[model samples]
Target: MLGPGAADVAFEVNGHPASVHVPPHHTLLDALRDELGLTGAKRVCDEGTCGACTVLVDGRPTYSCMTLAVACEGRSIETVEGLAHDGQLDPVQQAFIATDAYQCGFCTPGQIMSVVALLRANKAPTAEDVHRAVAGNLCRCGAYPGIVEAALRAARARRR
Candidate 1:
């Protein structure tokens, strides 16, 4: 079932190496969801306007829906699923739950990825920084206050 221009792309995802066969036209979102079974990056907006498909590419937040799988070859891709370790939730995930940072949970993954990048660069981010970090993500449930609070809380937890 291989079509013209279909090829294999190899990349490291969530600390594991993966090679997926996809057409050159396939987006990272398509490969991650349909091929690799990494559905943490949702496909809410195929147009890339929404950050629901956000993932970390070499520690930088990227919209998977807008990025081609071939473009990610040899790069590190980290979805929300990659944030946690051996049964322990990432502080950001814990804070999101503890602070009630999400409603409906559709946009939480992208928001969390953005915050993860921000926290990596600035361990102690201000409210403004948190807001700026996730501005690309759209939350229809409108839980931004909780999101901001969670980001700050996560920062504090990281400090300890």
Candidate 2:
């Protein structure tokens, strides 16, 4: 168990090993953003209701703001920043761009991360599946239609 003060927490982030000293009360969102400088996961709605801080913990969608940094030790954490490789965007990210799924873009990262997790579990997801995947993420601009379309498009693109 981690003490109240700063404790060393090591884990895999975006396929790379990372270690950070954080307090027991520090959240994974804070660790990712402040310690690791991964600002892709926005800090909106720090209460975990808006899903702006959604990230993949062990390949599952988790609210980083609600998850403690110490609790994530030994887990594989995937953020939106880690989705792309070799300068190529992930299909879901590309689809989001092609479909214009974002307006202000604050929630795009979390939405994309949720869809990525969904695609990992089901390569060809139905419309309902897409809805369920991004249900936790809220687009204040009301871009749900485009977000759903982008998810379906990404699923089709992954099939090829």
For each candidate in turn, the TM-score is 0.97, 0.98
Mark the 10 consecutive residues where model 2 has the least summed lDDT. 1-10
Reference-based lDDT, each prediction:
0.94, 0.95
Q: Pairing residues by index, what is the TM-score of model 2?
A: 0.98
User: How many clashes does each candidate structure show, in the order listed?
Assistant: 0, 0
lDDT of 2 at 52: 97
TM-score, structure 1 vs. true? 0.97
Q: lDDT (0-100) at residue 96 of candidate 2?
A: 98
Q: What is the lDDT of residue 74 in candidate 2?
A: 99
lDDT of 2 by residue, 23-133 (tens): 999999999999999999999989989999999999999999999999999999999999898999999999999999999999999999999999999988999999898
Q: Please list all clashing residue pairs in model 1, or write none if there are none.
A: none
- lDDT, candidate 1, 1-160, per-residue tens: 3455789899999999999999988999999999999899999979989999999999999999999998898999999999889999999999999999998999999999999999999999999999999999999999999999999999999999
